[model samples]
Target: MKSITVRQLADQFQLEVLVGEEQLQREVTKARAHRPGLEFVGYFEFFPTEHVQILGKKEINYLHALTDLERNLHIGNIVKYHPPCFIVTSDQSGLKYLKRYCEEEGIPLLRTKLRTTPFIGALDAYLLKVLAPEISIHGVCLNVSGIGVLLRGKSGIGKSETAHTLIRRGHRLVADDVVVLKKLSEQTLLGTHNEVTKEFLALRSVGLVNVVRLYGRKAFQDETRIVLDIELTKWRENELNNELELEPKFVKYMDVSIPHIEIQLQPGRDVAGLIEAAANNWYLKQQGYSAAEEFMKRLEF
Candidate 1:
């Protein structure tokens, strides 16, 4: 992750720092880590380092005199301070002592026009990539209301077909044919658009179809969490009684056991609608409701 300096942050928004201008050379942490300094900027013992900074308009005026002892604290000692970048929420009346201190210390004061939530969202996304361990996977990705549903099948039982149908049903398509999967956490997989297959899909009769023209902006997305997996299998009459999902079925992708379901496909079935139903069912399951369990309860004597 790239580190940000107080000066750089200040320059980005043209804000003046209130104090610690001499400490403008401090290094900002870009990503999350187990290291005590993961969320802080600069290492201890660095002579020209920034220890504390504020971001907001209202809070900047509240900061007062900095004691000699507070200033004498080493980089390591200051890191323990964990001062937050005070994000200004509104326009300030005028400059204060802190701003002058920032100028004297060469510490950067920054401002942002974005709302608090959006600014943090953008910042967090950038930071996650730097801080989190990530991995990629090869499969098909479907975005249903922001949830990434990955489909896995050998050769061509009908991964693309199901994805196409799902899109027609108002769901967004992340990737088809060849999905590039990435692991974002210990238990979460993020599916996203692959350059090779972005806005494209292969249909048995239609060949390659443009998902954007056919479905529009809502029908496509950059990436989403891989929350469900549907495996396509050729229909077999003899397998019904033998098949069992008493325990939840799952597939391993990057050390994560993704929740999954198997759908037997054959002629004369509305596969598209079925997949949609499966998605709804999976969503309901997340809310602690299961159709099969409810049916079983009704059948009990």
Candidate 2:
């Protein structure tokens, strides 16, 4: 199983470490955080020790309401299980109950100023991306007119060149040359560039191009959901277009079949414009409008 160090989670959210400083290096195996409400009230039937524990306002207040002996007993039940860490949300100050035990047991006790709901949401988002199934492919993913378009084809088939043109035309580049795609859901894929080369774009003749230096931040977006897949095929006179239909077709990647389009390429063809048009057409179809369907209705009339 993939895991991230507790220190990574603390650093990402700017969480303050209250105790167990040395244990920050310990790995967090689960992506989800657990809030043990019933456990505090003396129910430990289905204790989830696998996930990190979070304490919100309600749980902290309940512990404070209990007598010293009761509080100690309730906290003991939680500490004995060896949870990865304890995160106190909303900066609740009364949870001095957790610090001593967490320190003695070497479990990280962290505090965040963010409210419990937003903090858990952000933590879950980050953890899901880090722990999710991922694949790297040779393609360029861009945001064209608010649509996530992934350009994929054989090497030297002008994927980068087409992406370069799209960037010049004010479309944001999510990833170029190599795209890291993470499956966020069964139907959704998140596309992004590698951390080391996120700001660089590659070209055949000129080598590496710094997109940030040339186009600045406006031309770059961190990541996008890959909603459309366009495959650039070398133009063959006799080839037929099979994927073009009123009913949408898809290109499969790790069980995610995104709406797919195949564009035949020849020298001097306006490939970038065609890509933009395809995105717009797909967007139109999504909103219950199709040019093909309208044309067929005209033929019937």
Candidate 3:
């Protein structure tokens, strides 16, 4: 979990502050931005204070159409609840008076030149990324054949090296070493790297190497949704029975169950190739084709 402040949002969008500059440090904790649609209709029973309010053209016009008493009473009622902030879109004028009530309540009042739809679209996306629930895992996340694959195993078990190989084969690396995983939605887990480790991978013999510098920009992706988890393990004679996998194991990240596979490594085994195959196979499963299930059906096993 990360904390995002009103100041950060204001700075990110380059919004102009109309008042309550001192309260800009207030946190913007919710991903859903509210429009006060219910509040204006005299419904305050479920006013969501968690959301950052947006006053678009419709709301602005509605306000001006009302009598002075009605408008003041409505604005006062809403402002008293104290939302994270109020963002007026379209550079709409004549609404700065809303700033008066906002200032009285110590709520930050802001404005953006972007129209309502695009600003809200970008704002929702920004909030989704920043306020998403996050966890840190040790692995290399990559975009392989449009599927997000996470490589996890023991330390120095060649995860980074396998990822390097994948990058060379035209796949894109999302993160190496410390993979930051964020739950963008109930089922989507997005993997990324922090500033310190982004675009860099460490190998046993070679030191830290920037994949983008060597492989160029096409070999790197800032973030990718993790659809598969692949763990590499030293090949063991006892586990040979499971080598011909008929089913994929399941792993959970933030309560989302994702398909999991394990690859046993040997001296000459193509680890990268197997991982790539797993990604493609998972993608195929998504499109209603499962090799393991088909094989089992043919064998009647």
Candidate 4:
């Protein structure tokens, strides 16, 4: 149910407000734009009234060719539907009547200098990003070896400490505590830091520290595409070991599957080194080099 106001769109694109100053707060619920070409010719059955109406060169020319009475009737029919707003592309000069009608009817009208194709593309891109499905996860996300690694575990499992060590080793932290995950597409999930805890990492005894200020801007990144998920587990007695040479596992978030790995924590273990090795191994796998598979082939020979 998220919506963007006509005023917000105008400000974002720096579009000229042709009329309907009082209707600036009108909300557009749909991301797609509709061309009123058919609607102008008395075909209003399947018209998209919730989307932003776009008037381009052909539609304007058609309007100009119509007789005055016909044009008025067509425009009046469209106005009665109460579309979210109207955008006239290319800044066409013969839109005086359209502008006057919109002003009198209090329908927000905007003008942009860009052609129809480019304007629609840009607007659609922005709206898709703003309205994309999003979810927040409790984990620490970092860019390790150019791969986004998400660390998840219980509260006292040292996830923050491990991330801090990784930052010291020249890795960048994307988020801590709560990571806002946005489904960019069917197979892509983007992770970003929560606004309240951005750039700040909390440690048990050391208290809160700003990673950006302490380790420079390179130690923190705004967001990253999450490609790997790692869960830290406490070492327990008589626990079964998972076969590392088997096919990779996956974790689903927002209906997208990401490669998943689990690491057990024990005393006297170099967790940071292990994480770095995991990232490098992931990179190698991406490049089609699997050490386990190679070793199995050698054993078979």
Native RMSD of candidate 1 (Å): 6.5
User: Quick one: ranking by lDDT, best first?
Assistant: 3, 2, 4, 1
lDDT of each candidate versus the true structure: 0.61, 0.89, 0.89, 0.88
Q: Which candidate tops TM-score?
A: 3
Segments of candidate 4 deviating more than 4 angstroms: 35-47, 56-79, 237-244, 280-289
Clashing pairs in 3: none
TM-score of each: 0.65, 0.93, 0.94, 0.82
Q: Give per-residue lDDT, candidate 4, residue 229.
A: 91
Ranking by TM-score: 3, 2, 4, 1
After the best TM-score superposition of candidate 2, give how far the Cα of residue 286 lies from its true spot, in angstroms: 2.2
lDDT of 2 by residue, 240-276 (tens): 5553354667988889999987889988889999999
TM-score: model 4 vs. ground truth: 0.82
Worst 10 residues of 1 by lDDT: 32-41
- lDDT of model 3 at position 72: 91
Cα error of candidate 2 at position 51, Å: 1.9
What are the runs in model 2 whose C-alpha is more than 4 Å off? Answer: 44-46, 241-247
**Model 2, residue 233: what's the lDDT?**
92
**Residue-level lDDT tens digits of model 4 in 247-290:** 77999998999999878899888888888998899889889998
Which window of ten consecutive residues has the lowest lDDT sum in model 4?
237-246
Q: Cα miss at 252, model 3 (Å)?
A: 1.2
RMSD of each: 6.5, 2.0, 2.0, 3.1
